[model samples]
Target: MFPENKKQLKLIYFNMKKIVAYILLVFIIPIASKAQNVSPLYKDSIQLQWVNEKYDSMTLEEKVGQLFIVAAYSNRDASHENDILKLIEQENIGGLIFMQDQAVHQIDLTNKYQTASKIPLLIGMDAEWGLAMRLKDVERFPWNMTLGALKNDELVYEVGKQIGVQANRMGVQFNFSPSVDVNVNPNNPIIGNRSFGSNPDRVAAKGIAYMNGMKAQNVLSSAKHFPGHGNTDQDSHKTLPLVPDNKADLEKYHVAPFKKMIDAGVQSIMVAHLNIPALEPDPKIPSTLSKRIITDYLKGELQFKGIIITDALNMDGVAKMYPPGDVDYRAFVAGNDILLFSQNVKVGKQKIIDAINKGEISEERLEESVKKILMAKYITGLNDLKFLDSKNIFEDLNSDVNKALTTTIFEKSSTIVKNDNKVLPIKKLKQKIAFVPLEQTDYDQFLTHLQKYTNVELVNVKNPSEINLLKDYDAIIVGAFLSNESVYKPYKLSDNSKAIINVLPQDKKTIFSLFTSPYGLKDLDLAKFDAVTVHYQNTKEAQVAAAQTIFGAIGVDATLPVEINANLKEGKGIATKHIKRLGFSAPENVGLGKKNF
Candidate 1:
């Protein structure tokens, strides 16, 4: 029996036949359903037939090429483009994962590369939150942790659908997103804000919701960092992260979301570079390179029939473990359908060809992976390849509709974790209030919004004289905007900021609104504040939402998705009422239909 939340239980009853098929797969039974039905992106038998036809017509070298999905960049020079062109023309690389660049540059390069390729290339990106994750000048959405705060999973689905829409517009086929890692470890360096939450069932529900949204737009979704990368303290990009959980623990926490995702029909699963000792006994061996983990466990035990991809091979997690050609070939032998971001495609391809020729890697195994790749290409409508229309690219990506849905998500996600003394909804607007901005960068947005409600004085907390002046105010509204750059960056308050916060009058009402990760609370003393609001990230929408929440312009409905300390447990939220005000609304909203909710 599969683990199901209340929502999922209702979903099971609604789609009983699909649930039955999933149950049968758990017992290793072959699904008789058509491939089109397996994933919503597939239209009919014609697509499946086309996949077979393509696979049958492919040469041995081309079949080998289908397994390698090399990395590309829109910000690179002609040399890089020429290299990629060579890979497409000679090596016949099947796909590409576009890295950081602008939408226009990426689209132009994608067109150029596709034109050079013999077969239509499968374009993919790591657009977890949105296109802004890997591109410049694109609309950015709230992080998964922010979305995790909302009670409604449907909003999270809209986030995915919008991301899919943007990806489709940019000529991307696969989106390596909806990271289903159950982030239980607060110290987890890589998958902190990227993950939905620490709860397995919640993560599973959110992952499925996101995948289905992408599927609606015919943009394939990839549930990533598989078997789980949630509990590690180390970054796989630098070195291998060892997950200490045993088999039973993994099944309960780590593998739960991946299982649910597979059942919901995810197109691909990106295997993390973590060294999971419970799944594979070999010490220092990345899970991406372990045949026992990828082939025997994932394919055999878990019964995952879709494409299995390795996380970027260029990452030191697996790269440091073996030579240039060895790791890529090992990944192929380990049952990965796509070798993503391989360090050396030339050597890797030759080694894989050698392995196949010598019967080390069987032809049947090679064919199976190649066929899956072709099926994915066909399902994504690559069979009818079309050039990406570059008209209104920037304006379309940053549309009013996208901003409206994003604002709604931020409004719902902004939470009040500790509102002691009922300092919030500062009804006494007549009282003296001072807004102290604490951040590395300028955060005038919060101050700007706060001034709209009341005559709030802006005080630079960096100065010692200003810290002394804060005591004169009836309430000190400390707006701390910590950076959410990468998990690798320190997200705690600076010494100067901490000193200012510590010096603030404990007796006076201090409304501390943190525009950062909730984990940022662990570094500061909670006793210092009269009230605390966790606004997840310092996005423009979050800044406005925090201010609105303070003045009772909007109600606080979100709860903490992750625990900061013992007193502030997960899902801890204090509700507040909204005051009568002229509220703003976008009538031309994109993904905010009542049917979705």
Candidate 2:
């Protein structure tokens, strides 16, 4: 009898320890979930039930409306609002993709649109680099090309997570991003900086991280321009770009990333308006409207079960091919779940209705897409949707955390391509250094930051006649800045700029820093420069990071994401050891203890 009491006491102690462990587990899980990916929405029973219940209550016209995601803009006046409202009221469109607008304004319009619609509207944006891509004066992450150079995909995940956090705060449901295109072509007018890199493996790894990061915040992501938008010389917005690669080569290079994305359980894929004869037999038909490409291949062959969305139907790649209603019908028949940026919602909805009525398209087909859209809405938390409290949204979106993360990304992505004779880190502080601006934009931040480490003289020479003035310095640091980093803009240096760089004095050690895409390095002979660095962007943070790296405050780790030429191929980077001249310390330790600078 005494033995029984002792055994019971031992069991109680074990149970107490288990309870403590359980409590710790609950608290620690979310903290360690930064790298975790969210499960697919369609797999959840509760969301499916909500979808079924909502689908049962919908009329045929309402079901048809769920397929259309129309374009919306906050930059417009009451006329635009009234126009969008009319479509919501009359056509019952399912969603809105906000284009260009300020952060607060977009939130306000989102609230107004959601209230006006009978069904809670799904809001989407082309925020590949966060809302800063569309909105002004907001927090911005680096482009995909910059991110591709990063050795740590975790940093890319963090970038995606931050973008997701900001997007969720603004009530955006979908981020039509992570263009999983492999940029094999240097002259790709559209996907130059938008793509991760030339390597399919690198693109896939980065795309997976980005997709998972957004998923963690319950924001749906679409790996876009599927089949792949990279390797095309022309912009799809202008015309249908041709991808001449055979099936095996296409699979090896362009389509590889998309396959990886799908395998990684990407929630959706946006079909590109590309013409690939290897995949689609008809050259006239773009992938967006091809049954063989979308239904047979992407859906059947790839076994992708997620939502298939079309690229903006208004783009010239598909828009010029057919009229509004006809093109929308073909896209639906081709098996896209969402028709994005439909040219005319009214005509498209009516066309689908007519097709359903005539038995050309079954009611079951309509139900499939409508139910899927409803499931997405429920999964994105639209069922318990709360109107955003805009009082501190601007401040929240541009928080210290956002700025710090962006600065960190800039630091990590800076790459040194050439450092001959161990000339980097500018070890000789006693040597006279001249800061030359080979840019149309301002280089004040770069110059100012350079002065923090050592004495530097500013040299402004716009033409060859003024170049003689630079002969006095022991070393010349040239900042080749690109003001407009747009893909449509010129990335190559001007003839005059090239002439000045090429003719720089051979006697003086010349170190060149490019503040633009690595593709700009194509024409210039990089051999002349004793040391070279590619910072990718001309932003203040990038400028500061470049300066720090030059002075050995930070070491270089990022590699070239794309090939500039045969010699400067992909994955080329010079890893420089840190000098620790500007090391981390407390403010007081550095002789500045005041709270305000």
Candidate 1 wrong stretches, greater than 4 Å = 1-43, 463-467, 484-488, 584-597
What TM-score quantifies how close candidate 2 is to the native fold? 0.91
lDDT of 2 by residue, 1-597 (tens): 333687898988899999988876886455334212333446455666788888889889998999999999989899999999998988889999999977788888888988999999989999998888888778678889989999999988988888889889989999999988988888888888888999999999999999989888989999988999887899889899999999999999988899999889888899999999999989999999999999999988987777889999999999999999788988999999999999888888888899999999999888877877887898789999899877898788886666766777788898999999978988899989998888666787889889998899998888887889988889999999887445355677888888888778889888999988999899898877999999887778888889988989888799999988988999999998788777432344345545336
Can you give the lDDT of residue 94 in candidate 1? 92
TM-score for each candidate, following the candidate numbering: 0.90, 0.91
Pairs of residues at least 3 apart in sequence or in different chains that clash in candidate 1: none
lDDT of 2 at 327: 89
> Distance from true position, residue 111, model 1, in Å?
1.8
